[model samples]
Target: MKILIIEDEIQLVQSISEYLQTENYTCEYALTYRQAVHKVLKHNYDCILLDLMLPGGDGMQILEEMKRLKKMDGVIIISARGAFEDKISGLQIGADDYLSKPFHLPELAARIYSVVRRRNFGNSNIIDENELQINLLAKTATINNVELSLTKKEFDLLLYFISNRNCVISKNALAEHLSGDIAGMLDNYDYIYAHIKNLKKKLNDAGCRNYLKTIYGSGYKWEI
Candidate 1:
């Protein structure tokens, strides 16, 4: 899954990014309040790790902006221990969870996965949709009990589709989600097309149903 880290501590950001990378999550960063506001407005992520104290502005304002935009990305407020008021206020403003500093990486991973799964997986580690089965923890997919050989990008693409099934997802969103870089850094969406092509081929060849649909002028959809 894609994660956005809004933290001013460069060391903490690096540590979180490195550890989450090991857990198969693509992470992006915003070290200042301005950067956080920009990303929360423009980009999309499965989960956002938001720190309440920022370099330029209060992080609560960022959450307010997210609410203003009606953005649905799950947010987890990261604050110092004993800041119960901040935690309560953050949850009231729509943060899905809260974590204090000096936390364990494993706990952080579990909390992040919990928030993402609540948004997409419906409280299960496995997604069983008729003939198709996906193991979120394992990052694996299967059709009729036969495992499909998929690249990491391909697996992420499949999960993205299934998670937001029946919605038309634009090429720009797909590109940014799959890429570690920001939206402006992308040259074009040709790489997205390639990934979809390979993903379709693998699914089709594996005797899976053709649920992937291209929306002609808009984007792609999993039209289950």
Candidate 2:
């Protein structure tokens, strides 16, 4: 899954990004409110770690904008402001959870896991799509009880396709999703094709049906 850490404190943002990256999550950073708002509006994320205070503006404004724009990105408020009113206001504005500062990294990871599970996987750690079964916590995929030897990127690709099943996903979208914002500016997307090819081959080798489909000039789709 992907996470966005919106924090003004450079040290805090770095710490969060490093920790989350170790937890098998692709993370993007926003050090100021402008960057935060731009990322929130531009891309989709599994979860966002938002700080109430920012360099250019209040983090609450970011949440309000997300609400106004009807973005469904899961948000977790990570801030020094621990008052009940702040929590209520954030939740009312569409935050999925609140985590006060001076908390353990494991707790934050747990909160992210819960929010992402609820938002993307229907609150379940296990996803069952016919003969294919994926365990989110374990980060494993099995087809007909046989585990497929997949790289982390391939597994992430498979999960991304499943999450947006039956929808035509553009190459630009896939590149951004897997490679973060920088990939969006790049001209080439051949790396995405490589990942998809490897994922499909592994799935086919495991005796699974060919659910991965190419949309020709458009993109790719998981036609379940």
Candidate 3:
């Protein structure tokens, strides 16, 4: 899933970005409110980690703008202000969850997962797509009651595709989702080809029809 972190603390931002990257989440950062607004208006994200106090402008203003745009982006407010009123105001303004500063990274990750699960995955632990079944919590996949041993990237790739089924996904977008922000520095998207090829082979071998299609000269599409 794609996450935007609107935090001002450099060290905290880096640490959170690194941790989420390890968890297979694509992260983008904005240290100031202006940057945050720009990103929110420009791109779509699964969730946003927003800090209440920010330089240039209050983070709540950014949230208000997001709502004005009618964006369905999920937001989790992270602030040093733990007052009851602050939490209430955030929720009243449409924040999905609130996290106080000095919180555990694991806890934050869990909350983010919960919010995304509720918003995108119907708050279910398992996602079913035709003959394919995925245990989101366990991070496992089965087709026709047969399990496939997949690498971490392979599993994540499959999950992303299935979650966005019938949508055309560019190669760059796929790489960014799978590899995070640093994917841009890569010399080539050759690894994407390798992963897609391997995933297709595995699924086909497991008696699943190849649902992945190469949108020649553009990207890929996973359709029924």
- How well does model 2 score by local distance difference test? 0.84
Scored against the true structure, residue 110 in model 1 reaches a CA lDDT of 56
Q: Summarize candidate 1's per-residue lDDT along 1-224 as a digit string, tens digits.
A: 99999999999999889878866789999999999999888889999999988989999899998898899999998876438788888999999998887564544665786688879976467988789999887878999999999999899788777755666677876775676345558677787899999999999998988999999989887887
Total clashing pairs in model 2: 0
Q: Which stretches of candidate 2 lie over 4 Å from their true place?
A: 123-224
- What TM-score does structure 2 among the candidates reach? 0.56
Q: Estimate each model's TM-score.
A: 0.56, 0.56, 0.57
Measured on C-alpha atoms, candidate 1 has an lDDT of 0.84
RMSD of each: 13.4, 13.1, 11.5
lDDT of 2 by residue, 1-224 (tens): 88999988888877777767766789998998999999999999999999998899999999998899999999999989888899999998899998788654545665686688878766367988999999887889999999989999998778777765666667876776677657848889898888898899899999999999999999887887
| lDDT of model 2, residue 204 | 93
For model 2, where is the 10-residue window of minimal lDDT? 102-111
Ranking by lDDT: 3, 2, 1
Assess the local accuracy of residue 147 in candidate 3 as a C-alpha lDDT between 0 and 100.
88
CA lDDT scores, all candidates in order:
0.84, 0.84, 0.84
